[model samples]
Target: MINSHQALSDTVISNGYCVGCGACAVPEQSPFKILMDSYGQYRAHMDDSPVFGRTDSSYEELCPFSSSAPNEDDIAKQYYAETCEHHPQAGYYKGVYVGHVAEDEFRTRGSSGGMGTWVLHELLDKKRVDYVIHVRSETADKDLNNIPFKYQVSRTLDEVRLGGKSRYYPIELSQVLKTVRDQPGRYAVVGVPCFIKSVRLLQAQDPILAERIKYCVGLVCGHLKSAHYAESLAWQMGIPPSELEAIDFRIKDPSQPANRYSTYAKGPSGEKVVPTNNLFGADWGAGTFKYKACDFCDDVFAETADVVLGDAWLPEYVQDSDGTNVVITRNSDIQLLIENARNDGRLALDDLSIEKAVQSQDAGLRHRKISIGYRLHCEKEANAWVPTKRTKPSRTLNPRHEMKRQRLRTELRDLSHKSFLVAKKTGDLSVYTTAMTPVYNRYLIQKRSFLRRTYFLVKKTLKAMIGR
Candidate 1:
C-alpha cells in the first residue's frame, strides 16, 4: 500500500520522472521549491518542516506525470476543438508551412529559422501581448562560463529579438508565472512541449493565468537535457566546465549542411567553436544527459499549443546552412499574421502537407510514440511507477527493427542517469566518453548489421507481394 499524501514526491520527484516544469511551486505559499540537484538537473524539493498530517492534492493535478493530469489529446480537444485536424504524429493543426524570416541576418542567427523570434516580434509590435516570456542566456561581468540561463519577461521588440535562438538549457516557469499573476498584463509564452503543457495546466486551475497568458507557442522537442550537456560539450572544446561563461548551442557553419551546426563557448581562456559532431556524446539518440520524463512523453508536435515550430529537416531545406523552420499554425489570428507576412514579402513560406510534416520528425515520432511503449514495459518490469501516457505500452515492435529499438531503449534509459552521475562525481567528461562509447558502438552495430538490413528488405518484399 502507498500513501496518497506523498504521491507527488514519491511518484515523480523520487523516481526521476519530474520534468522541471515548476508547476508545483507556482502557488505563493506552496511547500515545494525548484532546485538544481547534484546531477545538474532541476528538481522539486519539499519543505522538511512538517505542518500537517494531510497533503494538498492540488500539486498532483498540475503535475504532467501524475495520473490526474490530462493527456495531450484531451487538452487539445478541450482547447482546439473543431477548428483543427488531429494526427497521431503531428497532433491537431489548422495549417502547416516550411518557411523562414525574409531578413538574412535574423535567419542566420536562429537555431533553425527565425520564425519563433518573428512571431514574438509580431505579438509585441502589434500590441497583441504586453509581454513576451521566453528563455535567454544569462550574462554577468563576473564569470562568463558559469552563467545560468533563465525565463524572462521581455517588454519590447528589441528585448524579444535579443532572446532569439534555441536555448537547450533547463528552465522552469514558476517564478515568471508568479510575476504574471501579481502584475496583470497580456502575455505570450514560448517553451518546449512539456513546459507549454504545464502552462496550459496551470491556466486551467487559476483564472489569473488563464486571463493573462494570451498565447502559447511551442517548440518541437526530442528531449530535454540537463546542465551537464553544456558542460560536457564545453569540456570537449578545451574549456573546463567550471570556467565556462557563456555557450551557444547552435551556430551556422557555411561549409556544412543545415543539419550540421557548431557550438560556441566563451570561457576565461577566450572562446572556442567546435562542430557538434566532433564532440563526444553529441549523438542525440543515445540520450546521454536527457531527462527521464522525456521518454514517457508522446506529444511531439505540442498538441495543446496555439502554434508549434521546429527545424525543417527535409531534403529541400537541408542544403541551406541558414536553416528553415517547419511550422504548424492552430490559431486563426496567428495564421492570418503569417499569411499576411508571406503576401507582403516579409516572410518566405510554402505549403507543407501534414504527411510531410509528420515525415519531418519521423525518427522523433517513432521514438516518442512507438518506442515509448517498450520503455514503459521496462519500467513496469522493474516495478517503477510510470506516468499515465496517451500511448499505451506494448512489447510488440516491428520484427525487422526490434533488436535495434530494444538496444536503444535500454541504453538510453540507463545512460541518461548513469552518465550524469559519473560526470558530476568525477568532474571529468572522459568518464562519460569511456563508458558510452562501447554502448553506442553496439547500438550502431545493430542498426547497420547485414541481418537487420536483410530483414527489412524481406519484409518490404512480402508486403509488396501481399498487396499485389
Candidate 2:
C-alpha cells in the first residue's frame, strides 16, 4: 500500500482529485492544511515539519478520492440494505418527491426549494441535534480577511436561517470539523456528495466524529465551483475580485422561472444583481471554474446521505418562480418528518416516481455516469492514478459526442488552473474571458452539432418504442 501522505499527494493532490472536504486536516494535530489556491479552489497542502511522524493511513482511508474509501454503491449497500429502492444513476431512496416548503418566506429565500434549510431548521427546533454544521457568510468582521462564506456551527434558528441559500463558493470542513471534534454536541451537517462520503469514511474510523455528527444531509451536486465563479459573476456586475465582499448564488427573481435565478454581489460601492444568463462564464455545463475532481465523481444524488435535496429541474416544476425541490429521503425519521409537514400544511409535496428523481438531474447524471467512463479511460491511457469509481470505464460513446466530451474534459482540466493563474497575474477578469470564450464556443458548437442531435433523436425513438 502506498504511504498515506504519498498516496494522497501523488494520486489525489497531484492528479487533482482532492475535493478539499477537510477530512485529512480535521484530525487532532493534523499535519495537512487546507488552503485556497491561486485558482480560488480549496486544496490540501502538507506542512514541511516532520513532527507528525509517518502519515497516518487513516487520512488515505477517509479520503473520498482514495481507492481505500468505499465506493458510493458499497456505502449505499451498507446504509440502505434491502429496504431501499435503487436506480442506476440515483442510487438508493426510500421515497422521491417534488415539493416545496409551504412557508413563503423560507421558500423565497432558499436556493431552490429551501427544503434543505428547513430540514436543518427542524432538526434544531425539535432538539434532535444540538447544533447544525452548515455554510454561511463569514461575519463582516471575518469577511475582511477571509472569503465571503465558510462552514460554521449554528446553534440557533436565527443562525440557521442566515445560511439559507446555496453557496457555490469553495469551502472545506477542516476548521469547522476540528471544532466539532473539540466541542460537545449532536450535529447534522449539510454538504455536497463527496464531502458527505468523506464524512462517512471519517466516521467509520473516528468514533468521536461518528457520535457527534448524527445526520448527513447532502445536496445533489452538479459540480463544485472555484472562488473565481463568484468573482466572474461579480465582475460582470462591475465588481472586481478585490472589492467583492459577498455573493449570493441564488436570488429568486419574481418574473423569472425557477431555473433562471439571479446572482447578487456586494462590493464597496453597492450591491448589484444580475440574471445568471446575462453573465459570461455562468453556464454550468461549460465548467468555467469547476474543480477538476468533480469530473471524476459519479454520485449525482449523494447516495450515502440520510437525505438528498436538489432543484426540481423537470419541466413541470421549472417554471415555478418561488422555487421547488426534488427530494430523496433514505432515513425513515426524516421521511416521516416530511410526511408530517405535508400533512400539517407546512409543506406541499407530491409523490414522485423514481424515474423522475433520475430525470431531475438528467444532465448531471449523463455527465457523471456516462462521460465519466470516457474520462477515466483517458486518465488510464495517460498512466494517471484515477480514483476507483463504481461506474466502469468504457469508450462506448457516440463519435460526435465523444469528441465533444473529450474537449470539454480537457478544457475544464486546464481551465481550473490556467484561468485562475492568468487572472492572478493580470489582476483582471478579462484574461479569464479571453481564454474561456473560444473554448466555450467550441463546446456550444459540439452541443448543437447535427450528428449529436441525430444521435439523441435515434436514442429517444428507440427508448419510446421500448416504452422506456
Candidate 3:
C-alpha cells in the first residue's frame, strides 16, 4: 500500500498526469492533501505519514491517472457490460437523445439545455438520491479569495438550481466525497469525463462510497480548464484575479447561436459581460490553462458514468439559442427518467442517432482519439512515466498538417501555464499574451485554407519584391 502511494506521488504527480480529482485524499486520515497551487489548479500533495486503510481504496486504485488503476473500460464493464451497447467514443449507451428542457427556465438558465440540473433535480424529487453533490458558485464562502466555484452538497431542488450552469473551473472531490462517507445517504455526483472516471475508480474499491453514491452523472467535456482559465477570462473583463469575486462561464445569447454564449465576471467596483469569443482563452481547441492530463484522456462522453450530458453541436441543433443536450445513457434508470420526461412534454427531445451524437463533438474526438498517440509518443521520447491510456503510443499521423497542429496545441497548453505565472508575477497580462501570440498565430495559420495560405504567401513575396 505504501509503495503504491509512493509510486503515485512519484509518477502521476511528478509526471503531470494528476487532474486533482481528490479521490486519493478522500479516505479518513489520508496522507494526501488536496491543495490549489499557484497556477490555480488543485493537486494532491503527499505527506510523510503513510496513514490509510479506512476504505478499500489506494492511490494506485483510486487515481484515474494511475497505470495500476482500473481503466474506464474495466470499471464500466462492471456496471454496464451486460446491458449497454458500447462504442469507441460513446462508451456504453442504452439510448442517445438530443433536445432541451421544455418545462421551465432550465433551458434558459443553464449552460446548455439544462438536462444536467434537470436530471439531478429529478433524482432529488424522486427520492432516488438524498443529496446532489455538484459544483456551485462560492457565494456561501465569506472569504474574498475563494475559488469562484466549488463542489457542494445540494439537498433541495432550489439548491440544485443554484448550481445549474456548466462550470469549466477546477474543483476537487476530496471534501465532498468525505462528506458522503461521514454522512450516510444516497448521493448523485456531477462532474466531467475524467472526474467521473475517478469516481468510478474509487467506487470500485470503496463499498461505502459505492453504496452511497447512487448515481454518477457526467458532463461531456472538451477538456478541463485550470482555475487560471477563470482568472484569465475575468482579468480580460477588467476584473483582475486578485479582486476576482465571481464569474459565469456560459451566458446564452438568443440573437446568436447557442454555442455563441457570453461570459460574465464581477469584481469590487463593478461587473462586465463579454462575448466569450472576445475573451483570450475562449477557444476551447487552443486549450489555454488546460491540465496536461486532459490531453491524454480519450473518453469524451464520460463512458463510465450512468448518463453523460453535453451540448448537441450538430448543425440541426446549433441554431437554437436555448441550447440542446446530447445525452448518452448507460444506466436504465437515467434513460427511463429522460424518456418519461420527453413523453410527458417536460423535455423536448428526439432520439439522436449514434452517428449524430458522435458528430456533435467531432473536433474533440479527433484531438483525443486520433491525435492522442502522438502525445503519448512525445512522452515516451522524453522518457517520462506516462499514464497507461486506452490509446497506445504512435506517431503515424497523416497529412503532416495534423501533426504540426497537435504540436502547437501542446505548446499552447504548456506556455499558457508558464506565461500566466509570469503575468501574475509582473501584474501585466501582456506577458502571457506576448508569449502566446506568435504560437497561437502559427496555430491559426496551420488551420488556414490552402487558397488563403497561397494568397498570403503571394502577398508576402510581392511585398518583399516591391521593397527590394
Candidate 4:
C-alpha cells in the first residue's frame, strides 16, 4: 500500500512532478503550505497561522500543479483560439494589436516599461482585485540563484514599486497555490507562459478559482537562466558574490545612451554601475539556459493572458532606452482603462502593430513549434519507447544568403569590439566590459572612432582589388 507520508514527501528532481511555478507558497495564511526542502523540490508543510486557512479553493483549482487535469486536446484548442466566451471578460479573442498606453504612474519606476507593475497597481488601487499574487525574492544573497518566493499583494503603488523587477530565481507555482488556499482574497497574477497555463488548468479542476482569480498578466520569456549567470555577471564587475549587497537587473541611468544597459548594485565598499549586456545578452532569446520546460511551451505569447507585455525590440527602438513595453490586451475593460488613462493624460500612448510585435520576439517564437518535439520526447519516455531522430529537409543554400549571414556576424563582432574600446577610453570598468573583455581582448574592440572605420574600409578595398 502507498503510504500517505510517502506521497507528501515525493518532491524530487526526477520522480517528482513539480513544475516550479510559485502557486504553493502563495497563501501567507495557510495552516499547512508548500515549501522548497533541502533537495530544491517543494513539499507541503504545516503552517497554522491564523491568516492561513481552508478558505475558498479558488487559487488551488486554478493551479497548474494540481493533480487532476482535463483533456489535452480540448485545453489546447481553447488556448489556441484564446476565447473563454462564457466568462465575464468576453470579446477577448485575438485580433489586430489592441491600442497602447504608457501610464505615467508606472513608466519609469517598473521592471520593464512598468506595465506589469502598473496593471497590478491598477487592480489593487482601483479595488478591482483584493490582492495581487506575484513572485518576490526570499533570499538576501541572490548569488545562490535558488531563492524561495513569497506571493503577496501591494495595497498601493508604493508597495508594488518596492518589489519592482526582483525577478527572483527558482520561483515555482506550487508555492502560489498554497498561498491562495490560506489567504482568502481576490487576486490577480503575473507569470511566464507556462505559469499562466497552469493557472488556467487549475481553474478547470477547482470551481473556487474560477471565482477568485481576477486577472492574469504574462511576461515574454524565451528561457529561464540559472543563478550562476548572475554570479558570473557580478564577478565580472569586480564585485565578487560575497561582497555584493543588492543587485538590480534593470538599472536606468538616463545619463547614458539608450541601448547601453546599466545594472546597479550595492556592495560592502559602495555602489557600482555595471553595464547589463555582459550580465545578459541584448537579445536574450538567442542564448543558452533557455529552460528545458520552455522548450515544450507553445504559449510563448501568453495567448491566455488578459493582457501580455514584453520589451519592444526593433531597429527604431534601439534608442530611447528607458525601455518601451510591447503590450497586448485581451480584455476589453483593461483596454478601456488604458485608453481612458491615455485620454486623460495619465499615460503616454503608442500604436503598435501585431506584425512588428511578433518580429521583436522572432527567435523565441520559432521554439513554439520546437516544443512539440519535447512533448513527443516526453511521451516516448513515459512509454519506454526508443527515440529516433527524424531527417530534416535541407533548404536550397545560396552563397549570397550565406554571405549575408557571414556579413551580419562580422558586423556584430565589429560592433561588439567598438563598444569595448569606448568603455576602455571612458574608463568605465563595468560588468558589460569585463564579462565580454575576453572576446574583445582576442579580437580588437570596435573603437568606431575614425581609426577603426578607416581600417575596415582599407581592408574592403584590398579584398576588392584581390578579386580583380
Give the number of the best model, judged by lDDT: 3
lDDT score of model 4? 0.53
What lDDT score belongs to each candidate, Candidate 1 first? 0.82, 0.84, 0.87, 0.53
Task: Give the TM-score (vs. native) of candidate 1.
Answer: 0.93
TM-score-best of 3 and 4: 3
Per-residue CA lDDT of model 2 for 72-147, tens digit only, reads 8888898887778888788899979898998746787788888989999998988889999998878823442235
For residues 1-468, write the lDDT of model 4, one tens digit per residue. 532223222321123334455444343333335554433333445343435234434433333433233322345456444443221111123432322235554556565577777777777777888877776655523531123345555455555555556363446665456556667788788887667777777666555676688788877766554333343455556766556555666776676544566766666677677878655333443332233334344455666677777776666664666766777776666677666766786656577666777776765664443333443344454653221212121232232233223223233333443443444345454634554545433332322332466688799999999999
Ranking 1 against 4 by TM-score, winner: 1
Ten contiguous residues minimizing lDDT sum, candidate 3: 139-148
Clashing pairs in 2: none
> Which digits, one per residue and each the tens of the lDDT, describe model 3 over residues 1-468?
357678888999988888999989986667788898888888999887645453334668889888898888888899998998888877888899998899877887788899999999998998899999998877743531235688999888888877788888889999999899889999999999889988888787789999999899999989888889998998988988898887888888888998899988878988888999998868998889999999999989898899999999999989988899998898988888888888899999899888899999998998998899988998899988898899899966865567888889999999999999999999999999999999999988887753476698899999999999
Worst 10 residues of 1 by lDDT: 138-147
Q: Each candidate: how many clashes?
A: 4, 0, 0, 36
lDDT at residue 426 of model 1 (Cα atoms): 80
Candidate 3 segments whose C-alpha is farther than 4 A from its true place? 49-57, 140-147, 449-468
Candidate 1 structure quality by residue, lDDT tens digits, 281-392 = 7777767678888988898888888999999889988889988999999998888888998999888999999999888898889888988888787788788888889877
lDDT, residue 147, candidate 2: 52
Q: Which residue runs does candidate 1 get wrong by more than 4 Å? A: 1-5, 51-55, 140-146, 400-404, 407-409, 450-468
What is the lDDT for 392 in model 3? Answer: 92
TM-score, candidate number 2: 0.94
